[model samples]
Structure formats: C-alpha cells, structure tokens
Target: MGESGAYRRLPVAERRRQLLVAALDLFSHRPPEQVSIDDIASAAGASRPLVYRYFPGGRQQIYEAALRSAAEQLTACFTEPPAGTPTQRLRNALDRYLAFVADHDAGFSALVRGGCVTETSRTTAIIDEVRRAAAEQVFVHLGVPAPGLMLRMAVRSWIAAVETVSLIWLDEGRQPPADQLRDWLIDHFVAVLTATAAGDPQSSEVLSGFLAAVEGQPRSVR
Candidate 1:
C-alpha cells in the first residue's frame, strides 16, 4: 500500500486483483469503452503509475480481468448439486445461471458484447469451457455414453441454445423467466431421454450416436 523510490509495497497479485475489482465496478455503470484507466485507478484508490505497473496494457487488461472475475463467480454457482432428480438439477443450473447474470448485470452485459466483437476476444475460451461442461453434465446425467461427433455437436448445440436463450433475455432487458426456461429445458430433455428409455429403437439409436459424439467419437450425420 506504500511506495518507495523504486518499489511499491503491494504485491503484484494483490494489485491486479484490486484493479479488477475497480474495473468491475466501473463496468457496471457504463460500457467498457466508456471507462478509462484513470477511472479504474481512481476507483481503486491507487496512483495511475501504480495501476499501470499492475496492468500495463491498460483497458484490455482490465476488461479481461473483469471478465475473468465474472466467469469465476458464475462457475462458483455450479459448484454443488442439491438433492434432486435430473430435471431438478437442470432447473437448478438454469436458476443459478440467470441469478448470476442478474447479480452482475453490468459485467455480464459487457462480457457478452466484448466476446462477440472478436473471436479472439477475452472470455471466449472461458465461455466455451463453461458451455462444454454444462453439456457434459446434461448428457452424463441422462446416462448417455456421450462420445463422437454427435457428442461434440450435441453438447455444443445444447450449450449454445442455453446461452443464446439467456443472451436474448438479457438483450430484452428482462431476466430470463426462470420457471419458463426450466420447464422448456426439462421438456426437451425428457423428450429425448424418454424416447430412448422407451422401446423406440430408432430414438434409442439416434440418442446413442449423439451421446457417442459427446464422448468424443466420430459420427456421420447422414
């Protein structure tokens, strides 16, 4: 917190963390582009030089840090599953997902916009990982093998669907109707799994193939 001729007292990690906290607060009030390093440094109660020392690249660094913070918070929501059926678990995930967006309204909005601007944008990889993990959870819970191209496509598609739904809701400036979203997901899940569970051999076959793709196996779509 103090400084001398050539060195400051705060550790590098702590300074970066403080910078991110400051950036997140600023982002909540306005878009990322509207914010400046001075704003962040001012909010952080640190000198501009000190802020630069922690994040020399400036805005981009702060933006990425803000995103990382959001991702970490969202991931924390999924850390545990309460006692419930598969449907309950899916509902719980959706509930938590929406709650996360609502809780960090500004930061989540910025992340969505920032990520779309470039494929190389910050948080893309983190989002991808989150989606993949969610998909895996869905398939695995249904007792599917989750292998191959179908697996890949299914999980990716599923995750995209969920994210897209959430994004649309956010864009509309409405919290995704949690009950409605949960019911919809549950219905889609039941349709597939129930068909497979029934004696419908074709549905079972298709599901098995999809699950295989999810498990990293290759499958011909045709």
Candidate 2:
C-alpha cells in the first residue's frame, strides 16, 4: 500500500471539524492574511482541494468560521452557574476570558483590534454580538432583569475595559499574572457600578443587591 493508502477516511462532519480546528489553530497564532489554504490543508493532514470543498469562499470563509467559533467560546466565558457573589461570579467569568486570551493571544488581538485585511461587516457584527452578549450576562448576574440606561452603560463600559485590558495584557507579555489582572478588572467593575449607583436609583438598587451578595460571603471568600 502507498503512503496515501495508510490513512483512514473521515466522515464528512469529522473532516469538516478537523479542517476548522486546523484553521482556528493557525488563526490563533497569526493574522488571517498570513494564513493560506495550503497551511490549513497541511495542518489538517489533507489536501488544499479538500479545504476548498469545505469552505468555498476560501481563506475568507475559513477566517469567518474560525472567528465565529472563537466568538462563541468568548461569549461562553461569561456564562457561570448562578452560585457566587456578583464579584465572585464576575471573577469566574474573567478567569475563563483571560485564559482564552492567553491561549489565543494573537487571534484575540486581531479580533479586538480589527484591522485585518480579511475583516468584513459580518466579522465586525460577530465581535459586537460577543460584547453585547457579555454585557447582558453581566446584567443577569447583577440580578437586574431590565437595566436602566446608566446601568446598561456601566455594564457595557466594563466589558470594553475588559477587552482593552486583555489586549494590553497580551502586549505586556501577560505580566502581573492573570489572577492580578482578573482582580483588577473586578475592582474596576465594582468602582464603575458603585459610582453609577450614587445618582441613578436603578443602579443604586442593583448595587445594593450586588453588595448584599458580596457581604454574605465569608471573609476568606472575599
């Protein structure tokens, strides 16, 4: 048997998954423009044509798919089981997010900064959706079913801060450890919410509930 005959065949779904995994791996380390169809094909142990068969739009399509996958994972980072204080819960979510940023430093940078040659309206929308979803999850954690304008703005601003700091963390070679960064971000969120609570009745209520949760926790936990 020849070398090609030594390989086993993968089902269509499995083949597609493999190709996506390879593409995502490349995208995680380098910008989309630097990656090629042959790179993905070679990384997946397949031919270039097979990649084309899976993604007809070529590199752009593959980049989009990878971006979508990354966005899903990033959004999921904010999804913690409703069990901790608001601060603890946000910390948990930030833990997951920071881990992802550390794992996919290059791709996270590209996704947040957004000047890639392959970027499109669709990709921009996907990024925006991730931010919206994160802010919404944060609101849910704060026990606010319907947040007011100030409350909503505070949450969105915290999300933006997380993105900006994550990018800076990557640039700084992830110094001061992920835990320090996570704690700093949580403190930032608390500061923002506390300041907003001073003038907005809606925000004040939410802040009270959040603080109650934090206060109920053991000192060690805090």
Specify the highest-TM-score model's number.
2
* Tens digit per residue, CA lDDT, model 1, 36-80: 888988898887888777778777776776777777777666554
Evaluate residue 53 in candidate 1 and report its C-alpha lDDT on the 0 to 100 scale.
77
Give the clashing residue pairs of candidate 2, or none. none
Each prediction's RMSD over C-alphas, in Å, is: 7.2, 3.2
Would you list the C-alpha lDDT of every candidate in the order shown?
A: 0.64, 0.85
How do all models score by TM-score?
A: 0.70, 0.93
Residue runs of model 2 more than 4 Å from their true location after superposition: 1-8, 217-222
lDDT of 2 by residue, 51-99 (tens): 8888999999999998898899889988998885778778889899999
Runs with alpha carbons beyond 4 Å of true place in candidate 1:
1-11, 113-122, 143-145, 191-222
